[model samples]
Target: MSILYVDHEINNLNSFKATFRRDAEIYLAESTEEGLKILGENKIDVIFADHQMPDMTGLEFLTLASNQYPSSIRVLLTGNAYTDEFKRAAGKGYFHSYVNKPWDEQQLRKLMISNLR
Candidate 1:
């Protein structure tokens, strides 16, 4: 399976990649623009985007990506608690999952594989 993860924090990007690289084909990006480019060039099975980003919030990017790649599962990650934005995204079917920051690797891995299945 292919996983696309976008985070504005370079350290988070690196850490995520390090944790999950062995699981599948992993694509990492430090911005929404780079994430979009990766999505364009790849047939991603899953996507993870940070809630707060520079160019646009993860909500915006994932919503757009969901429109363009309906088959891919989209997940939003955030350091803050769930808010109205998440409720809207999930209600609209733009988000398949919402994960809090400092995610548990085992749970996340299970989430990814389950989504693929």
Candidate 2:
């Protein structure tokens, strides 16, 4: 499965790539625009976006993505424990799930594997 990860921090992006590179085809983007571009060009199966981006919030990007590519599973990653925001997004059908910034690698891997299936 192909997965796209969008984050402003290079290190975070790098870490994600390193963590999941062996598991799937990984695409990395540093901005929403870049992520959108990648989405347009690739058949992404899943997408994970950092919530606190500089230009657009991850939910905003995921909302656009949901309209453009509804089949791709969306996931939000946030540093803050904003359950209300996460719940609202999920209720709106913008994202399938939300992950904390310092996420458990095993749980995330499992989530990705299950969603891809």
TM-score of every candidate: 0.96, 0.95
> Could you give me the TM-score of model 1 versus the true structure?
0.96
Model 2: residues >4 Å from true position, as ranges? none
The collision pairs in model 1 are: none
For residues 25-114, write the lDDT of model 2, one tens digit per residue. 999999999999999999999999999999999999999999999999999999988778678879989999889987678978888988
Name the weakest run of 10 consecutive residues (lDDT summed) in model 1: 101-110
RMSD of each: 0.9, 0.9
Q: Give the TM-score comparing model 2 with the true structure, all chains together.
A: 0.95
Off by over 4 Å in 1: none
Report how far residue 69 has shifted in candidate 2, in Å: 0.5
